[model samples]
Target: MSLDLTLCPDCGAPAEVEWRAVMESTDGPVEHARVRCLRGHWYLLPVASLAGPGCRLAQSPTSFRE
Candidate 1:
């Protein structure tokens, strides 16, 4: 099955996500993504996958941390 793209659970809006940077953390390179909803709900997604853009995964409702 084709994997579904990342979407805002609050408004069901498609997440406008892009890689911001790779910070050096204790775990290693922490991939960061900037996501914003149509309603201007900004969010930062901390993930490990850096395959490429347009890659998104389901995030928790409270995943919008800073």
Candidate 2:
């Protein structure tokens, strides 16, 4: 399935969403999508609300420093 993206929150331009991966869990399946704006800004979408229509920003774990 394809992702339905809204207007970019960063540039107010149209954004495109591409499916990246899906994590299977006992609770259910979680879908992940990559969103990119026309200006080339990228963001990771963590869809905890899989069965619904919502998502949250996901920061890369590897980007953290101790």
Could you give candidate 1's per-residue lDDT for residues 1-66 as a string of tens digits? 332246654676656564476777887788677767668776676754422344233544333443
Q: All candidates' lDDT scores? A: 0.55, 0.53
Error of 1 at 37 (Å): 0.6
C-alpha TM-scores of all predictions: 0.51, 0.45
Instruction: Predict model 2's lDDT versus the native.
Output: 0.53
Candidate 1 ranges beyond 4 A from true positions: 1-5, 48-66
Residue 47 C-alpha lDDT in model 1: 51
* Candidate 1: RMSD to truth: 9.7
Candidate of highest TM-score: 1
Q: lDDT: which candidate is best?
A: 1
lDDT of 2 by residue, 1-66 (tens): 544554455765455565567867687887776777767887766644222333221222122222
In model 1, the clashing pairs are none
Summing lDDT over every window of 10 consecutive residues in candidate 2, give the lowest-scoring window. Answer: 55-64
CA lDDT for candidate 1: 0.55
Candidate 1 C-alpha error for residue 31, in Å:
0.8
